[model samples]
Target chain A: MRNDGETIELIERLARLVTNEGHAHGLKPAQWEALRYLARANRFSRTPGGLTAYLGLTKGTVSQTLMSLERAGLVEKTANPGDARSVQLGLTEKGRALLPLDGMATIQKAFEALPQPLRATLGDGVAALVTSALAARSGRAFGICHDCRHFAADARGPGQHYCRLLKQPLEDAEAEQICQEQEAA
Target chain B: MRNDGETIELIERLARLVTNEGHAHGLKPAQWEALRYLARANRFSRTPGGLTAYLGLTKGTVSQTLMSLERAGLVEKTANPGDARSVQLGLTEKGRALLPLDGMATIQKAFEALPQPLRATLGDGVAALVTSALAARSGRAFGICHDCRHFAADARGPGQHYCRLLKQPLEDAEAEQICQEQEAA
Candidate 1:
């Protein structure tokens, strides 16, 4: 069996390789991360503050990254309807178009080629590692809505769900998207 | 079975989480990466050019990262005896002492708790993903010396090996370290 040190080493190398791949499309590594987060986050998790928490970066760095993305026409910001003082963020058409063609295509192909059981095992192992690390550091999990403790199922409706904390109905699609307020269920 | 998209998403999330973990220890994400690389890299692979290739970053970015590490007194540079024009990098005592106590301690504990087979499977899957992504992008593998095509085994010695690329004999420990010039055998 491989020792703990080797496992940590492999994880570190994989993380670096994945990040370097994200740098290929005229974006810095951090920019790619922010863009990807915005793409996955639900509407409620689309603010600069959400990004700052999700990326675990300084507010200044996240703001700078957002400004750069806004300048490139890849991301747009609008005043929040509920609170005009705050802003909401979303990817533009160009950003959405670039998502499917990013450097992760190769990684996706590699993952697709793995055996089903191995793929599941890998995912579980990685998820456990992420959960443990974040818990140790008191970092936010930013998990999918369906997995959060606040998720409440609607028994009468086939696909409807609710966020008990937000007091809002969640569509099927939104339930699958990541949320900044997610807590383990 | 999880589909390809889900597999890719898990890996991306894991990568981001792992990278964020490195940001907690008074080092930026990139600085921790560079320092970790220097700690595990062989003597021949400990140069600025090697780091640039291994990290797949521009010369300027790698230089800036190295400068930051130097300023923190975590890394030291000296002229390479084999080639005066190039310099070699090594971690200071302060750096070596910090390596064992980095933010990865929690990650290591998580990895240690995994069943051995699951751990091996996860490592293999990730390595395959990294190798495929790197190959698709024409990036260096930066693999261990023993895995390189240039690795030459000494029939008479029990553990001695040599690197044909560097024309240098490799200690057993050195043969286990990652090399910037590694090409799969």
Candidate 2:
């Protein structure tokens, strides 16, 4: 059996590799993570609180990161319809443009080069590790809408989905995006 | 075939998981990474420049990180014997003790629960990904001493290893640790 220490080291190396890749696009590691999160998160999951939970960072840090992104014209805050007290986040055209240059292309190509079965296994293994780590800290999983416990298929209409927790219908695109309220079914 | 975007998302989640885990130990994500690096790096790989290369961060950020770590008493710096102008780093006893509580134990346990073959495959896959990412960024791999191109087994006394690049005999412990000068053979 591979020793636990060796296994941990490999996982740590993988994490560092991703962090190092973030430095290529004039963004800090945290900023890259936030940008990616905003791009993939559902509308309901795009608030400051949602980001703070998803990133597991202090409120101040998340706020500061958002301010930096906003100042760079990469992200904008819009009024939240569900709650006017808070705002929703969205990436600007410039931010969407920058996503292609965020250095994920190289990683994507590298991942695709792996044997197909191994790639699947690696993804499963990593997902399990993320779940385990988050569970250890009582952190939210921020899973995609389709996998959430509250997800209801075709509850509203054909090609539409529903969130039992949010009591709202979800567009097809939102069903595929991650949500802060996601819980494993 | 799994899409490239899905593969990249999995990799990003894995990285964020590690970053979130760092919050539990009262250390920022960068500080945890620095501590882990010092603990696993070989004697020659423990310099600030080595860390900068490994992390792909600015020299200023690395310097600040080292300063924070030194202030926390988790790391100590000593003059490098090979280079008088540079310094070497090592983990303090307290730092070594803190590692067990740095939230890796949960991950180690979770990893051990995986099937042994899967664990091996996962490690190999992650190592390959890390190698690819570092190569893309022109960053140092900081690989294990035994895997380095310059490593010569049993080149010194009986059962002794050597690093041709550093012209240094390697203790068994150092052979297993990562080195700054390491390049794939």
Task: Please write out the lDDT profile of model 1 over residues B54-95, one tens digit for every residue.
Answer: 777899999999998999999999989868899999999998
B1-185 in candidate 2: lDDT tens per residue? 33557667877877777766776568887888888888888888789998988877789999999999899999999988757989998899988988777765666776777777777777766766766666666778777789889999988876699999989899888899988888889
DockQ category of candidate 1: medium
DockQ of each: 0.56, 0.55
Estimate, for each residue in A1-185, the C-alpha lDDT of model 2 and write its tens digit.
33557767767777777777777568887888889889999988899999999877788999999999999999999998857899999999999988888866778777777777777777766766666666767888877789888999999789788999989998888998988889888
Candidate 2 global Cα RMSD = 2.6
What does chain B score (TM) in every candidate? 0.91, 0.91
Q: Highest DockQ: which candidate?
A: 1
- Backbone clash pairs for candidate 2 read none
